[model samples]
Target: MKIYFANGLFALADRMFNEVVVDKIRKMDSNIEVYLPQENGDINDKMNYADSIKIAQEDNKELLSSDLIVAILDGDTMDDGVASEIGLAYGKEIPIIGVYTDLRQHGVENPEKLKAVGSIGENPFAYINNYTIGLIKMNGIVVNNIDSMLAEIRKYL
Candidate 1:
């Protein structure tokens, strides 16, 4: 199976996280092929020069041909490139597994947390773009952690 791994690649931590997750996914099955954008240094290398059109065309080609997309939605906001990839994948009918491991997303049952929602600037919950999430849920699902994400991927395997 071809899996498109979409996530932020700008920060060192983000790039390392993407690599670790992709490694785990690849280890799940030898037949699985994960296309991590960071791996394409030719286009993603900051020191090098890759035009916007070239970058989009290259990544879009892999995205469109993938059997699945594993999108990381853990950032402060959804990474723009990842969001666009999700949209394209949704339009193309490719299944998506979104990994949203934000810690603030927890504590649903805490009274203080729930009550804080009514207070201005005191809300403890994190907000992700509902439209992007909706698109993912329409054709696939959003998982809270890497374990759950892998579990969902196993279903396709």
Candidate 2:
């Protein structure tokens, strides 16, 4: 299976996902091919107009070609880039596997939620972005570890 590991480029999301999930998945199946955006994308430090275009093109190409997308929903909320990739996968009818480890609640834009999260580290009512979480649930399962992800993949494949 071809898998797209989507996450933020600037943050250490790539490295974290690589260490926690990608390595194990690769070792588990010889036939599986994983595409990591931070590692495989053509983004440069300068990030000229052409370079940005190239990067987006490369990422989108990989996303479209992949059979599954394992989006890292790290940080307090889902990263914007990862959300965009998820949208692409949804449009293409590609299965999405959300890897969210941050127990912190997201979408704190609401005043009540922000107040709740202020008292506690995370709001129990909202664990992540509502739409993103709902979307993932609709297409695929959201897992906290590689084991669940593997199980879902096995069942799906």
TM-score per prediction, in order, is 0.98, 0.77
Q: Which candidate leads the pack in lDDT?
A: 1
Give the Cα error of residue 64 in candidate 1, in Å.
Answer: 0.4
In candidate 1, where is summed lDDT lowest over 10 consecutive residues?
Answer: 38-47
Cα lDDT tens digits, model 1, 29-136, are 999999999999889888999999999999999999999999999888989999999999999999999999999989999999999999989979999999999999
Name model 1 segments beyond 4 Å from true: none
Model 2 CA lDDT for position 37 = 70
Residue 87 of model 1, lDDT score? 96
lDDT of 2 at 121: 65
